[model samples]
Structures are given as structure tokens and as C-alpha cells.
Target: MSINDHRLVQCNEKDEETLLIFKKGINDSYNGKISTWSTKKDCCAWEGVSCDNITGRVTELDLKQHFLEGEMNMSILKLEFLSYLDLSFNEFDVIRIPSIQDNITHTSNLLYLDLSFNSYVSSLSLAWLSAHSSLKYLNLSGIDLHKETNLLQAVNTLPSLLELHLSECNLNNFITNPFMEYLNLSSLLTLDLSKNNFSSQLPNQFFNQTKDLTYLDLSWNNIHGSIPHSWKNMKYLDYINLWSNKLSGEALVHLSGWKQLRIMNLGENEFSGTIPINMSQILKVVILRANQFEGNIPTQIFNLSYLFHLDLADNKLSGSIPKSVYNLTQMIKFTMNDRTMAVVELFTKGQEYEVQQIETNRQTIDLSANYLSGEVPSELFHLVQLQTLNLSRNNLIGTIPKIIGGMKNLESLDLSNNKLCGEIPQSMSLLNFLEYLNISYNNFNGKIPTGTQLQSFNASSYIGNPKLCGAPLENCNIKEQNPKTPTTSMKNEDGDSIRESLYLGMGVGFAAGFWGICGSLFLIRKWRHAYFRFVDGVGDKLNVTLMVKLNRFH
Candidate 1:
């Protein structure tokens, strides 16, 4: 058979409904990686296109971040063999409802779907996914799902669902329906509802009831009031992020029980009290910034052998950072940026990795913008994978450690508003990847080196230090030497020497006047004779000059 005839023969067995759906997806540019529209058999190798070898069934369809620009269409439902599908990260502008489920019902074997980062409305996709009993994983992030209060009520319909991600979807309307009440997501291991407007009082059973959940993210929302004691039951949860909200009450004692949690971010809230002492055992990353916590961190906080990132900024916490942190050589990333809820991500194998399998906790420690003082620990200079190091807006003093130049991977350094002194290190010129440098508002002196990173920084980054001069300053020649700033000496102020001479002259005149009033020495003949004899004895006598002057007059 001819090649074109052979291609036609291959596609002849596909169901008419499936053929129509595939044609519509190709028309929509959803399968954009396909450069040309050819016969089904000819287009099977296109991006996001997958097929079963024996059955010739189009089973998997993944079109993520493909920039396939168009409105979404329901035609996707016709491919009954689709067991794994991803249409996320594409520019989907509208909803697409197709009579595809009935076709899938005939096939009876579909699983794994991700329509996240698209423009589907809230109830449209959630309702459909809930009804798919065969779906094991569903992700709909950044899609603004806001159609119903009991949005996930359809979840009760699915029994095989294991992972559901609904992050950044708008779930904040007053849907009087008790959405969290009816569902039993017992098999679920991960659920994400972070970055939403959900303000409804969360039912107590929301987390406590989720016994099988291992990862939960409810950050950047309005979920408030004291954390329920019911959360003590989440045994499998390994990560919890509750950042950027208004939850308060006794924090330290309440959070220590999650013995399995490895990553916890409770920063940017209104919690108070001492940092929990025994809390170090469970975590690899702990962020407790922007709260009312106080007192020294328990010395054991550093002993968490798994810990890589520890942030405790923007609090009333006092005292030195425990030196034990230096022992954390296994630590890959450590941060100290000014008070802010850091949204850092950790991945395996970073710059500090000896073996590529080790995990990196970037931006993990932020101790800036607090009352923290004392010299920066040199041991912290070892974290070469750190991205942002902010020692700004604190009372920290002394020179920037020379070892800090070893952090070749550091991007942003903010030592501003400190009592710190000394020249900006010339060794900093070697940070090839270093992008942003802010030593501004500090007591730093000398020239800022003319490297790509330092030269690119604006003059504002070096402000408030009159002693500092270089590329940012007009008078660049002052690069000669950075002088140690002198302080005023503590000595008594005295009058000028010229003034003292005048005082001495005045004293002599007064004494001479006093003697004249008592009896001028000239009036004392014996005194006069003694003075004349002494004068006459030395060199030529004064009388000889006097006689010469008399002879000239004669």
C-alpha cells in the first residue's frame, strides 16, 4: 500500500466521536506542537499526543505551557481512551462543555487528569472531575474556581481520587452550603487551597478529619481564629504552610505535635510566646518570622540534624544566634532577609551538593529586621547555595566576615541599617552569578568594587554611608584607602597659647606698676647701684656707650 493509504488505514478503526474530538483539539491549536494538520495516524507523534501501541488508542494527552492560544472546548471529552491528560499552563479563555463523558462511559477506563492553570470557571471542571470515579489525580490550580460554596461536593462522588490540587482558586464566596461537611477525602494524600479568598469559617473537621493527607497548603487566605485542637490527629502530614493570614493565640505549644512534618511556615501572623523547645526534632525547614515571639531560641533548635532552613525574624526575640548552627554543614541554604513571609522553594541537588541527591532549602533562614545584635557568625558563610542573605535593618555591628566572600552563589545581600563597619570586600568581585547587592544604609566604608554585580546596583543601595565611595559616588579617586572613622577625644578644652602670652604680659605689667607704687626700684639707691654694677661688668660697660653719645653731642 502507498504511505498515504497506509496512514489512512491506521486511523480507519478509531470511533467517529473520538475522531471528531481529536480534529477539534487540533483545530483549537491545543495540540499546537503539531506543525501541520495531517491524518490521525500521521499526527500521532505530535506534542501532548500519546497512543497505545497494541490498541492504537489515544490514551494520554498532555499539553502543558504550550502557549496554545484559544478558548477551551468540550471536544476533549470524546477521546474515551484518555487515561492521563494535562491541558494546564495553556491560555484557556472560556469554558468548554462537550458530550464526551458519555463516550468515556462506554470505554470505562480513564484516570489521571490535570486541567490546572487554565480559564475554566469553578464548578465546571470540579463538578466534572468529581463525577469521574476513575480519576486518581486532579489538579486545577490558578483557575479561579468560584461557582459554588459546596464546590467540592462532587468530590463525594469519586472513590479512587488520591491527589487534588486547587491552589490559587477563588473559594471565598458566602456559599451557605457546608462544603467541608459532606466530603470524606480519606484516601487523599495531598490537597492545596493556598492563595485564595476563602473567608468562610472553616469547619473544625477540615484538617483533623483528613487523616491520610500528607501535604496541605492554605497560605495567603483569610482563614482565621485560633487553630482548632483537632489538628493533633494529622499523622501523615509532612508539609503545612499557613503563612500570610490572621491566625493567633499560643503558637509554640500548639505546633510542636506534628512529629512527621518536615516543612512548616507559620510566619506573617499574630502569634506570641517563646519558640517551642522540643519542636526541633521533626522539621527540616521552619519559618517563624513576623510574630510576637520572645526570648532565646532553645539551644536544641540547631540540633535538628535534618534542619536546613530556620527563619526567626521580625519578633521581639532577643540574644545571639546559637553557635551550634555552624555544625549544620549538611545545611544547603540559610537566609536572614528582613521581616517578610518568604515563599522559598526547596529542591534536591543544589550548588553545595557533594552528592546530587541532597536537598536544598533555599531562603530558609530569615533573621533580619529585628533587635538581633552581635557579630555575624562566620560559620554561616559556608552555605554557598543561599540566594538571599538579608542582615538589614538590625542592630548588628562589626565587619563583614571575609569568609562571606566564599558564598559564590549568593544573589542578594542586604546589610543595611546596621552599625557594621569596614570596606566592602574586594573578594566580592568574584561573585559571577551575584545579581543584586544592597549594602546601603550601613556604616560600611571604602570603595564598592567595580564588578558587574556591584556596578549594576543603584546609588541608593549604598546610601547613608558617607565613608563609602566608588562607582556610585562622583569622587571615585577616594579609593586610595578606607580610613577608620575617628571619634572625639575626651580632653578638657583649654585657651589658645597666644591668649596665654597676653595674660602673662598683663601680669608683668601689673607687678611693675605695684612696685612703682610701693617705691620705684629707681628710688632705692643701693638697688640701683647693684643693678648698674652688674650691667657695667658685662661686655663693654653701658657707661662707655653713654660717654660716646655725650661726646658726639658736645
Candidate 2:
């Protein structure tokens, strides 16, 4: 239980008693996450507790998602050596954040603190955090901070802070002026202020100073107006999400300078004008749906080989789908690295889905609700690794090519409300992985191809097509007309030959009888005369018989 000359034991006796006291206050009856905190055992060996090897003092306490309920006990704060503490996702009904006026000497060594998602803990004041200058990461997400004033000015005191997450914290009151006259967070890399009540224009000066930011999320706010030109100063930004805001204008042209940007989401905004063609070449995901953007979709968008997800739905884009879509070879084969994983919210099969972690082979292309026309490019099926393909509610025409069967990995497919005609490709039956399908409201005809997967969907999938029929729909009922066999042909030929023979025999017999009678009359005069006499004698005998009968009657 000792190390290094036995000067320091496994855990200090005072820290062990403090941890036991901390456990007593928590109602761990549900999960019993801290059951090992016993007097007989070393406190450092307990779950979610880590101690300094040489100092024998608890330095890290992680109790996230432990299902422990009760008011937070301040006894754990006595461990002055603690540098990391997490109480996120617990059932704590009330938590009084330590104020600078209180005895916060124990938090002097704190480097990281997370109290996020303890929903019942409503009010928050970050005045005490200003004293913890050594703190590098702080997350108070899902905690209400509406009452706090001068919040940014208070956080500016932490010179070492790198990542700050205040999402869903109700910090709308202080966000109006998120910066001070002298900005101090030059080293900050990630900042998330999403799902707040920011009803004002975007802070113009704030972006000018946060040049070191690599990740910025201000989504789900009431922020209006164009993105400030100062945003171009954030050259290091790799991910930026301003989704579900009231932001408008063609100001995205300012992003031409962001060479390091990898994921950009400006969806569900009031943005108008054509999509920018000067997008970063290395961007992996771009979501610009539900905007007023019009004009042909830039072919340059397909030039991005690394792009696996592109959502341009609910726009006014016209013209044919660019055949250059086949250039997205990376989406067909590339294996994404762990650093490239992103969370994306996409609309597929009439529902919105949030994919927590995008996988390497999971690709999507949504061009629905656009003005796009002409045949669907066969090149689109080249992305065999695609998972969702939605081209619905467009002016698209022509048949779905048989090559679509190559996309066997498809899980959701929607081509509804288009002018597409012809039979649903028989090759589509090979797509055994299809889970959601909508081909309704098209000019499609003929029986639906047979397959367990195709038939599994409801009749609605085939609705709006009067000519389409089969299992999921009503039966076609029409039987096939096959070609005649050799046997049937030979039987008809034999019957014709028999009738010809009978007619020939009858004609030959009549000719022979007539010739025989004529030849006898010409060659033999006696026979000819006898034949005439026999006929006359018969006539005379008949006449004599008639005369005798008349005489008898008289």
C-alpha cells in the first residue's frame, strides 16, 4: 500500500474519510456505482476515483451518468489537489455553484470541470470560475445561466481555457455582447453556443479575435443577418454550424478563405442566391437545405472527391443532375479516419434523422424539392457505398437505370413526385438492404419486380401510379402470351395434308368415270348406241305404263 521509500501511502486517510462522506450523501440505490468506497479498502482503488501516485491525494473524480440522485455534497471539494471533476448526467436536484466569495481555495488546482445535463440545477453564476485561471476546459451545457450578467467578461479571466461548451444553458441574456473590449480567449479552439435564445445579429467583432478557433457551433438560435465579414479571420476553423437560424444574404462568399474547413452546415436558414462554387476542396459534409438558393447546382460541388454527404433539398436549383457525380469516388471506396467523423442531421423518407456518427461507407445525396429536370444520371449509381439517395419532388424524368442494383447498400431510397416512367427496375430487387422505399407519384408502369424486400413495403410505396401493379399493390392479373411450340405447328400441318388428299381422290374418281364413259362411246359405236337405246327404252316403257294406267282408269 506504499511506494517510493514508503513516504506516501496508496491514499491519504483524510481523503478516504472524505470520499466515504461524499458517498453517504448520494442515493446510489439504483446503480451503486460507488459501492467500493469502504473503510477497509484504499480510496484510490474505488470506481471513478483517481489519486496522485506520489502525493497520495485524490486528483480526479469522474461520476458521469452514474444514475446517482440527491443534492451534490461539497465534501469532495476538500481535496485541494483535485484537478479534474465530472458530475454530468446525474439526477442532482439542486447544485449551488461555488462563488468567488466562498472558500474556493480547494478549487485552486482544478484544470477541468463538467457539470452539464444536471437538468434540475437551474441557476448558474460563473463569477467563481474567474479565479480558476488554470482551468483549461469547462462545460456547463443544459444548465440555466439566464440570471448571470457579464458572463463573457467573467470567462475572459481564465487565460488557459481552450474549450468552452455552454450549449442549451439559457445564456441568451449575456450572448448579446459575447466579448469584452479586450478579448482574452485567443487560445480557445472549440466553442459551442447552440440552442440558445440569441435574437440579435451575429457578433461582428467576436470572430475577429477568435482566430484560433477550430470548431464553432452557433446553431439553433434566432441570429439574423449575414455572417459578418470578420468571420474570414477565423482561418483555423474546421467545423462551422449556423443551422436553424434566421441568417440571410449571400455572405457565405466570405468563407472562400477558410481552406481548413471540413464540415459546413448552414441549413434551414433564410439564405438566398446560388450556392457558392468556391467551396473548400477538402470539405467532407455540406448541408445547405431549406434555403432560397436558386440556379443550377454548381458542377464544381461534385469535384469534391472527399464529400460523402450533400444535402441541397428545398431549394430552387434547376438543370440536369451533373454527370460529374461519378467523380465522388471517395464516397464509394474511401475509409474515413476517426477524426473525420461528424454528426449530421438529414431529411430522408419524409423524416428527419440525426446520425450520431457518420460511418465510412454511409453516404447520402438529397436533391429533393428542387427544380432539377432530365434523366437521373446513370453516373449517380456509381456510388455503390451510398446508404440514402433522395431525389424526390423534382422534375426528374426517364427510367431508373438497372445499374441502381449495384447500390446494394442502400437503406433508404426516395424518388417520389418525379416524372420517372417505365417499370421499376428488376435489378432493384437485388437491393436486399432497402428498409425505406418511396417511388410514389411517378409515371411508372408495369408490375413491381418480385423480391421479399420490395414486397415488404406498404401499398403507399407504389401509390399514385395507376399502371403499376403487383404484390405490394393489386395483382396485374394479365397472363403472358408465349410463342407457339413445334409440336403444335406440326399437328396443324398434318391435318391440312389429310384434307388435300381427300379432295384430290374425289376429283380423280370423277375424271376417270367421265373419261371411261366418253372413250367407250367413241371407240365402240355399238356401246354408244346401246347406251342411247337403253335410255330411250326406259322412257318409252314409262310412257307405255302411264298410257295403260290411263286406259284402265277410263
Candidate 3:
């Protein structure tokens, strides 16, 4: 058949009608390009609608992130042959899932169902989901499932389920004991229950059943207590996020056997004790910040060449940073999530830009708010891709290395609250991309560097460094106000000497003039008589002039 003939083939009339009705149910304000679902065009060519090649029946209706509004019409149920249905990230205004009886009317062959990111939808029950036996990938995240008391029980029924994402779905009532007998979901690979209210110790029986699970995210929930040792059997597990929870104990020590593990986040929890020493080599991102993990960082962690982000901040961790840190050339950000100090993201439109935009290759190192004491490691300067370097609030001493300028990508640098002395490196002027700098409360002295980027900063950047001077600080070469000093005293003495010499010269000149005139008068008697006659005539003229002026005035 010619390509044009294939293109002309029309979609099933029933499927077209169903899709047209579905389009009508949506609000006109919806931003998605579903307007092309007109009868004039082939339904197979319509946006968000895909047809089966053989049957010409609609099988996929993907309208993800469309900003769509209004309720979902039951007309979609007419497409019983549909296998992939994705309405994720759309603005469905609190439309609840249809009841089991209504859903059962049309036995859908749905294999992938995604209604994630629809926050308004409240309540999910086993009855609504049990009708779909062929479902494998089910994502109902951001839905309110607080009242769904039999949540786990319903999930247990989906024998063919492979991936389940129930994140942010108020699963507060779901709790099971470690020994509780649960139906095994051996085929499941991904399970996400993060940002929920699952307040209870992790049930070992649950993870024990899903041994084939590769990705698990229980972060930002109320899952408390230690992770049970039984989870060690899930050897295939790769990614796990247990951050922002009340999970405690040395549970991480048990997860060493999971060789496939890569990303692990246990930050903002109560996990005490040293970081697990027997971590897998394939690990990439490890964040255990805001915990009480004491003792030195495990040297083995740095050997993970693929490791990108390592955040052990806000812990009681002591000892110097391991020398192996320099080996992490690919390390993008390494922090110890401490208070006030941070690895900042320099986004243009505030924090929102960070979420919407693609991530840039930013390298950072934050060892702030620790008892780590020693010379600032020279190896740090070699990480040329570094953007943020924060070593604030430590017992670090010695001068900042001049080679810091080699990190041309540096956007933020903070070395505040340390015992670092010596002059601020003039080489720092080479960092044209530097946007934020805080070297406050250090023993740094001498003139501040003069670069447009450096001078543009405020006085706070150099505050508490009483000896530091220049723009953004006081000028170092300003003259003192002391007039009694040796320089001023010498100036005063010179002035006195000049005054005495002037007096002496004037007296000599006066005497010489007087003696010359007297001697002249003594030698010549006629001269003395003439001088007296001249004086007498001048006095007579002065008297006559005064009298004439006085008479005129009268």
C-alpha cells in the first residue's frame, strides 16, 4: 500500500466518537493542543491519541502536563481496547475515581494507568482498582488516599503490578508489623510511597516480599525507627530515598550487600552512629546530612569514582576531610548540610528556575560547621569545575591558596568564621563568574582585592576582619590623626626656626637703616637740618589737610 493510502485510512468511528466526547469534557482554557480531534482530520493523527495499526482503534491517550481542567467523562470507558492511558500532571479538579460498579461496566484492557500529579483527587479504594487485572504500571501520586484504610490490601490484589507510585498520597493509616504476613509482589521493581504520612516502623514483611525491587522511595514520610535487617536480602535494590523522616539507628550498616545500590538519601533524619563503612562501589549520590553521625568520614567512600554528590553535613562528624576527596573528579557537590553554610544554586529566577530548567554541571564543596581543623587542603583547588566552595564555621587555619583563581567556574565562595590569616589572595580577582563571597570573621589582614566583582560586594563580606582594608572595607594606607608624632613635631620645629630667622633679619635691617641715617646726619649737619625741615613741612601739610576736610564736613 502507498504511504498516502495508509495515511488516509480512518480510525474506527466508535473510537473517534469516544475521543470527541472526551475532548468536549475538558475546559476550553486547557492549554494542550487537543483541538485537532475534529471529524475533518483522521483521528489517528489527533494530538494525544494513538490508534492500533491493525484494528484502527484508539489504544493510547497520553495527555500528561496539559494544564487540563474540568471532569473526566465516562466516554473514555468506550475505548475498552485501550492499553495505555496517561492523564498525569493535568488540572483535574478533585474528580474522584469512578466506583467499582461503574468501572466494571466496560472491562478495560488497561496495562498502564497514570493519574499522577492531580492533587485535587481525593480517596482511592481497592474496589476501584481491583477491576483492572491486566494493570502493570499504576501511578496515582498526589491523590488523597487518607481514607483508603485498606490501601495495602488493595495493592496486594494487583498481582501483575510492576511499578506503583503512590507518592504524596496521604497513606496515613497504612502500617504493618515486621512479622505481618503480606502477599508477595515479587514482580515489582519500583515502589514510591514518599511524602506520605506513613507513621510507623518499616514492616520487614513488606520489603521481604518485594525482593526484586530496584527503586524504593519512602522519603518525607513519617516512617520511624530503624530499617529492619531483612531488607538486606533485596540485593537488586539500586535507588532508595529515606530522607526527612524519623528513621534512626545504624540501619545503613545492613544495606552493604545491595551491590546494585547507587543513590541513597538519609538526610534530615535521626540516623546516629558512623556512616556505614561497607558501602557499595557503584554508589553515585549519598546524602546523610542533618544527622548525628559521628567519627571520621569513611576513606573508602572517596574511592567511588562515579560518586557525584556526597552530603554528610549537619552531623557531629569530626576529623579532617579525607585526602581521597581529590580523587572525586566527577564529584559535582559535596556538603555537610550545616546551618547558615551551604552549597548554593545560582539560578536567575530564584529557586523556581532550578526546578524548571535543566541542571548545569556545578561542582561544590561544603565542609562548614564542623570541628575539622587543619590547613585548607591544596587539593581542593584542583577541582577546576568547582562553582561553590564553603568551608565556613570551622577551626581551619592558614591562608587561602592563591591557586583558588584556577577554579574559574566559581560562583560562590565562603570561608567565614575561621582562623584563616594572611592577605586575601589577589588572584581571586581572576574569578569573573564569582557572584557570592563571604570571608567574614577571619584573621585575614591587608588590603582587599580591587576587581569590579570584588568591589561590588558589600562590607559584610569582610566584616570581623578588623585588619582588612580597601573598598568594601576601610582603606589600609590612611594617615593617622596624631599631630604630636615625630613627623608633625619636625614640621613644627622648622616653622619656629623660620620665624626666628625672619625676626633677626628684620632687626638687623632696621638697625642698619637707622645707623646709616644717623651717621649720615652726624657727618652732614645741613642734611640733619634739611631732614627736620622736610618733617616739619609734612606735619604742616597733614594739619592743613585735616582742617580743610573737617571744615568741609561741617
Pick the lDDT winner.
2
On the 0 to 100 scale, the lDDT of residue 296 in model 3 is 81
lDDT of each: 0.66, 0.82, 0.75
Q: lDDT by residue for model 1 over 1-554, one digit each (tens)?
A: 11232232233245334544544543354544534434553434444566665555667767677665545665566566768878787766665665544433454356887878765343455455544688788787887667644466676666777887777777665222566666678878777777886675556776655876777777778877777677767766687777777888776675666778777878788878888777737577787778888887677876676666677777887776666555453355454432222244321121222221224544345677777778777756776766667666778777887777788777667677888899888778777766666677778877887777678767887888888887866555632554333331212123356678899999999998998755745688887787778767864666688889999999
| Cα error of candidate 1 at position 391, Å | 1.6
Order the numbered candidates by lDDT, best leading.
2, 3, 1
Q: What is the lDDT of candidate 2?
A: 0.82
Query: What's each prediction's TM-score?
Result: 0.74, 0.82, 0.77
432-453, model 2: which lDDT tens digit per residue?
8998999999999888988898
Of 2 and 3, the candidate ranking higher by lDDT: 2
- Per residue, candidate 3 scores C-alpha lDDT tens digits across 299-374 of 7876776665566666787777676555674643444332211122222211211121112255445566767777
Question: What is the Cα-based lDDT of residue 230 in candidate 3?
Answer: 87
What's the residue-level lDDT of 425 in candidate 1?
81
